[model samples]
Structure formats: C-alpha cells, structure tokens
Target: MTSNDLGDFLRARRARLRPGDVGLASYGARRVAGLRREEVAVLAGMNSDYYARLEQGRERSPSPQILDSISSALRMDDEAREHLFRLAGTVPEGVRPRPRETVGSALRQLLDGYPNAPAFVLNPATDFLASNALADALFSPFESVDNLARMTFLDPAARSFFTRWERAAEAVVAALRHAAGLDAHYRNLHDLVGSLAGESEEFAALWSSHTVYGKTRDGKELLHPDVGPLSLTFQTFDVRGASGQQLVVYQAEPDSPSAQALALLGSLHATRHQGSATER
Candidate 1:
C-alpha cells in the first residue's frame, strides 16, 4: 500500500458506484460488471481509452482538473473530494501550512490556572503544543512525543488510554486528512498517514472506508487510568492567525469522577516536578 495504492483505491471506489449515484440511468446494457469505462470517461471528462488505462492501473497520474471532474462525476462530496486528492497526490493549491510554535508564557499560565479542566494547544498537524498537567495525565499517551496523529495510530498505549478508541481513532485520522487536503505539501502528514495505514489494520480499515471529518466543540470522553471513565466537553479555536495554531480546551463532566481526576491531575502536575511526593 504505497503511493501506487492511489490507482487501485480510486479504481475500486469508481467500480462500486451505481449509475443512480452519479445521476445516470441505465440504457439497457449487457455489461461485464460495474459502470462502463466510456460512461465514466464521459462523466469524468477524460478520454474513454485513457480512463480505461487509469482503471486498469496502466496509467497512474491524472491532472488536477481531470481528477476534480472525475470526483464530480462520481458524486463525491467535499470530504470525498479531499480524500481523492490526497490519494492522487494532488496537493491543494496555495496552501502553506504554518510551522509549529511553542506556547506563550501567558498560554502556559492559562493552562496552569485551569484547575478543573484540561487544556492543550496543537499545531496544524495535530501535534501537541503545550499540555497542562491535567492534560498530560489524561492524555498520557502523548507524553513521549508531540504528534497526536502518530500517537493515535502508532502508539501502543493509546488504544488502551483512550476510551472509545475506535471513535477517537477515526476523529484523529479524519482531522488529519482534512488538514492534508488543505495542504498537500504537508509532506509530514502524508508520511504519517501512510505509515499508519501500513502499520495498523484498524487505521487501514477506517481509511479505506473513505470517511472524513473535522474537529468539533463537543462530545469527548477519555478513560483515565487513575480516574476511570472521564467524559468531557471540548472546544478548539484559532489562537494565532499567523501560525495557524489552535487552542483546545477539555472540561470534565460536571461533578463526576472526572472532576476529581482533573483535580488530582493538577496536583500531580504542580508537585511531580518538584518530587515532594508522587502518584501515577
């Protein structure tokens, strides 16, 4: 499943379509299988023979305009279009992904003062920016490195760390895929998703299904080791326009065990560095 996968994936997706899905009607065809190459070519704005070559894997690359046409002919929604672009290696035009940045002292203090909630910042690539102690304790899977996408796909502990791992995993992948669509030159992101698709069967399964999504401002839950299941309301917002950085805030379920876990996490963050006493 390398870059060559682009041809096969596109071919498979095309073959699965029924005529009705693309606003086409059957005109009494005795066909071998699926939509005829000519039909798809007409809809996709490509030569019939050339479209056949693409489907047969004899031709791999297609121009952006052609791909967009094919996407439209296939009735692909925006999410589907983005996923198609990613597979076809067409980077979205004029997209410059902002570089990573260290959170400011003020932001760090804000996280520090969040006694009952967890807050962290993420770069465009979904890497951790600055996690407060509560965030650290709750999202401990991220402790090793800055990457959230990698952690979701590659980290061994993350599967167990996140409650509803499958859903969480999908969210991470979908968000990353959206970002990838916005910037095809997000080479690092492309590599990360590729690596994960190769390494994790779970990722492979979900990615192949062509699901796409963005981060929302609500409905998050994490199963903390010390605190059990902690549901939280979450929100994300732009923090720096120049950097394209986002501030993500997490709030525990009110009056739940998660609140206690958050308090414990704050204490842990506050004291663990000093080593007066410690508990995990």
Candidate 2:
C-alpha cells in the first residue's frame, strides 16, 4: 500500500460527486469536476487546510471520528468506508499471515459435484487456484486461466467471452481493491496490481477509482465459443479452514435455455476428455 492511497481514494470519490449531490447549490462554472476540496472540507465540518494536508499526504494519522466524517461527506458505501479506514490506518491491524493458494482435497471433491456447472477456486489475488472440468471448459477460450484480472483486461478473448465486458472489468478491479485493503502486506497482490496497472490502461483507471467490493452473489451473461450465449448466476463462498480462498460456483436456472446450453457444453467437454484419455 502506498502512502498516498488514502489521499488518492478521497480525491477519486470526491471527483465522482457533484455539488448538488450533497445538497449544495452550484453557482458558476467550476474549474474541476465534482465537489472541490474546500467543498468536501465544508461538508465534513472541518477546515479546508486540514483536509488539504490529509489529501497531500502531509497528515499521516487521522482519528476514527475524522475518517468517519470524511466517509460520510463522500457518501461512501459499507465496503468503501471500511477501505477508507484501512487506507487511513485508523483501523486496528491484525497479524494476517499469507494464505496458502492450494485448494484442499475436500474442496476439489465439492467442485466435482457440480458436473454441469462451472465451479472454481480463487485466491485473494484472483488467481485460478483450481477448477473443475466444467469450469475449465467454460474458460477454455483463454490461453491460460491464470488470473481473472489479466484475462479480463489483457486477454483478447475476454471481450467476446464476457457479454457484459465493461461490468466484468469493473467488478474484477473492484474486488482486487477490496482484497488489497484486507491483505495490505501481501506481496503477490501488490505485484499483481502493479503489473496490471502497467499493462492495461482501463485497469489502471478503474484501480485509481478505489472502488472496493467483494464478490458474494452475482449474475453474469457469458458468450461461450462453443455454447454461444449463456446467463449464469454465481455464488461465492469463503472456504472454511482456508484463509483468503473463495469457492465460486456458477449455475443456470433449471429447465432454462442457459441450463440446456451448459449441459451441452458439459457433454462436449466430457467427449473431448474421453477421447484424449483413449488416445493416451
């Protein structure tokens, strides 16, 4: 985490808000977009100079009350507010050892249970630790299913594979930011973010926005090379006894077209696997 992450987050969130967003009247043509520094300070009931010092990184330590005021002024959501506290270093820190990336045997068995669905395991940094056969087939279009962030922003196939490409991009970046906040000292996470920011402009821009979110349950629209269009809903579960590991399972509604498509994809995947094994 950079020393200026807090400031950058504050600036980004401030830029997203308009004068009228906080019940303030717009008077004349403003030089910058959204609320100005002074305006934010005013909303927070603090002097602009203090807020300026905080934004400029001159003020390193801020009290919880002050952070709360800033969070309220910026109209941050729960995740964003927690992230703000983390960046400001006002939240109590605990000893969080780096989590193992390996998925357990039981989890592997669980993933296998979803024969027609795509189920995979992901680390905090969004690395594809392990995936079931169906999940592998779902992501077969990518050259390598290494990292979701890389595949989403850097891969050519992602644009076509993800029907809502923009939303997917935003979501992955936001989830990464959330992970960074929780696991601040994880070196691999830092390296992943740095590499992505250097490679993809869109990722860099979204990262700068400081949008922090964790995936729990979400619906996705996907266009598979083999199966064509599919609408799937996924649920993410934190794996017990595995720190920073999440199990994601994607399913299509029963008796729906998407379900039929998923079944067909599974059949094709099984046939290919069987043929490969027979050849071996």
Candidate 3:
C-alpha cells in the first residue's frame, strides 16, 4: 500500500531488464548489469534525477504523457501499461464507474460457444470461476474452483498444469497487486494472496516485486493427459455490460495439430462422461 512497494518494483524491474531486451546497444565495458538510470531516462525522454525522484516517491502524480513514455521505454504492452496506471494510483478516467465488478451475459455466452477451445471470464482480481464446458475441460485444474489466486499459489497441481509455471505464477501475482490497487478493500482477495505468500517461496519473491499487468494476448502450451499438447491463444475483449470484467477467449490455431489434439480431448471427455452417465 505504501510508495516504497512501488519504488522497490521499479528498481527491481530496471535492474533485471537486459540492454538487449530494449534494443539498447552495449558499447562494451559497461558497469551496471542492466540499463542504468541515466540510460532509462534517455530512452523515456526524461531527466534522470526527475525519474529517480518519482521512483523515490518524492514526486507523486505523473501525467498520462509521461507514463506513456515510460511505459514505451520499458517495453510495456497495452495490458501492462494499463496495469501501470492502476499501480500508480490512477483511476480509469471517464464517467461513472462501477461499485462492484462482475462479468456480463454476452461474454458468458461467448465463452459457452467455444465448444473446443478453453475460455473464461475474469475480473480484475483474476478470479476465474466462470467458464464453459470446453474451458472447464482445458482448465480442469481450476474447474469449479472459484478462486484463481488460490489455484495458482496454493495448489500443488497448478505447477504441473502450465508449461511456464514460473512465468504464470508471476503474472498472477502481478495481476493481483494490480487489482488491489483498484480495489484495495478486497479483503477476501487480500487474505488469499497473503496465505499463498506465506506458503510458497516462489510467490513470496514475486510479491516483493510489485509488477502489475492485465491479460496479454498470448499462446499457452498446455499438456492435457488425453490430448498430449494443446497450443492455445488467449485473447481478451471488452465486456459490454461488465465494468471491470474482461472476456478471456482461448482458441487453438486453425488447421494446426494442436486444434486436432483439442478435438480429440473433447471427444474423449464427452464419451467418457456419457459412458459413466449410462452406467449410473
């Protein structure tokens, strides 16, 4: 909740980023491991001292323009940039906002329509209980699991579900922090994250660095027991009736082997379930 947390995040991220990541030429014999403060300032088109001051919390409010520049310099995507604004105590500028965030009907219907691909609707806090049959099949690890933060941090099986467990875990932690900014009073979410942090060292390290980000349009490689490997792309879209809810749609690339694999999983699941039902 304090500015120190935010400052710590900025410093940590800067230190970890490589010069090559942002296209900064290494002229040889460099002192710092990553880009220096001055180098970042140059890229962001800001004074080094001013950037430092902001990082130190000496300066509080930064304009949208400056944030945009800094976000670009840091190679932040749209999801990451919006997350930055939220982390910096800036609310979405507009008309009236919602008192409580919830997903809408249309998006829910859309999720249901994805018969083969896995999909779900999530709020800012990344709670992903809402999903269709196919999504449930793909994300069976969290099916009927109301709390995503819990599944991510608490569940031992979660580590085996995702190919990039570390990256996924960090993203969830960062997302929770971002949500906390928008809804700091979310006691339930706060409690869940706290409990997970207590148990998992991986989560604890990520929590120390306050990285905030929204959902990015990316592919996830999931190894289904029946399907073997399913390559899926997740895309987020605005929910018309939901204020903070974003529709997360997942699909396999058309005509790809992964798509066939997904179909096989679906067919196998249906047959198995139906057979059990007949026996009962």
Candidate 4:
C-alpha cells in the first residue's frame, strides 16, 4: 500500500529472471542475480533510463503498450501480467466495484440446500460471511472459523487440520495477494494483511514475494477431528449481484471414503442440531 509498491514489485520480479532464462548469453562477470535493468529495458524495447525510472518510483504511470511489452519481456503469465497492469495504473476500463461483504438470503438458502456438500459465502479477504451446517461442521476444528487466512496462519490447529499445510498456506497467501492487487484501499484486507504479517513470519515472507493467484477450483485434503481424513474438491463461483462475494462449495468424489465421511459428518451435525433444539 505504499507509493513504492510498484517499484518494489518490479524489483522483486526482476530478480527472478536470469540471462539464460530469457535466452541472453552471459557476457561478463555479473554483480547481481537475474537480468540487469538495462537488459529488461532492451527486452521491453524501451530506453534503459525509462525502465529504471519506472522501477525507482520516479515514473508513476506507463502506457498500456509499454506494460504489454514489459509483460512479454518478463515472460509473465496471465495472472502476473494482469497484476503488472494494475501496478502501472493501466487497469482496463469498465472495472467493477469492489465486492460487497454481505451475503444475500437467497445465496444462504442455496448453501443450506446442499445438505451433503459444505458451502460458504466468502469475501476477497476470506471472511466467512455465511455458511451451511455441513460447512460449519467441516471447519469445527478451529476455535473460530472466521477468516480462512487467519485460521491458516494464526491458529495452532491449522497445521493439523490441513493435511498439506504448506500448500494451504501458500494458496491462502496467493489469493490474498491477488485480492490486494484488486483493491489496495480495501480497509479490511489492509488490516488483515498487517495483522498477519506482524504475527506470522511465514505470512510476511510470502507476502513479500509478490505472488498473486485467484482461486477457481482446487482439491483439498483435510484432517477432521471426528472423521480423521477427508479429500474434497471445491469450486468457487462469483456471486452475480455481489462484486467481491464468492460462493464456495466443497464436494467429495462419489462412493469414495471421503464421500462416506462427509455424509457421516453431515448426519452428526444434523443430530446435534436436533438435540440442541430439543434441549431448548
């Protein structure tokens, strides 16, 4: 969120490339890692001074054509190329507003209709806006299932809950990075990143790496307290009316052990809810 974020990102990414990586032969003794600023400029078909200024915060804006050239010079993928444009303030026109935090009642109802699947409504910051009973049961291991990023990094149980903790942590950080790129002024996301970075060293390191990725679909392995192990795949759908809200639903492979475990977990949750209602 600093004025130098663009410069910092450029520096970080520049350090990731080597002369050989870009088909440039080593000519002399190199002082630092990756391609030099001049090399990048040459590759991008621009003056070295101009590219250097862009990386030094002296240049605030660059043309979309220049950004596209730089993107190719860096060999960036779709996600990284998009992030570069955002940093250069060359965002495409017709960009939608930031997604809302509230989940619609109809969406909540839809989540509940998935009795077997675990579904939740989430914002870009990974806040659990709403969830179905099965989803609640799925995440019941944590003391509070508030935000996915917070739970993954701050909670002691996360290491045990996610079978592949490292992957989970990286994915969470990348998603947050992507979200941060979308809206730098989003206060909740700003606060969450600050808190996580201050408390968690891993989070700080990953955030500094400038990795950006958005979640679409992914498979997850979880170690539920009651069910032992569960393998599930989740799909995230952007809410039609809400710009930032996402409906995430997790489902297990049919007839698999994970499917059976999910079913049993659902039954247990239902039984407990009924018992609580009866007691009341």
How does candidate 2 fare on TM-score?
Answer: 0.97
Q: Per-residue CA lDDT of candidate 1, range 72-103, in tens?
A: 87777777687677766676455554555677
The candidate that achieves the highest lDDT relative to the unseen native structure: 2
Tell me the lDDT of model 3 at 99: 26
Per-residue lDDT for 191-244 in model 2, tens only?
999999999999988988788888799999999999899999999998889999
Cα-based TM-score, every candidate? 0.70, 0.97, 0.74, 0.94
**lDDT per prediction?**
0.72, 0.91, 0.72, 0.89
lDDT against true structure, model 2: 0.91
Give the alpha carbon lDDT tens digit for every residue of 56-127 in model 3.
Answer: 977767888888888888777676677567656677544425423555666667777888777787766667
**Which parts of model 3 have CA positions greater than 4 angstroms off?**
1-3, 17-53, 62-84, 90-106, 141-144, 177-189, 275-280
Question: Residue 222 in candidate 1 has what lDDT?
Answer: 70
* 230: Cα error in model 1, Å: 1.0
The prediction achieving the highest TM-score against the true structure is 2
Worst 10 residues of 3 by lDDT: 92-101
Instruction: Determine the C-alpha RMSD for candidate 2 after optimal superposition of all C-alphas.
Output: 1.2
Distance (Å) between predicted and true CA of 149, model 4? 0.6
Give residue 93's lDDT in candidate 2 (0 to 100): 67
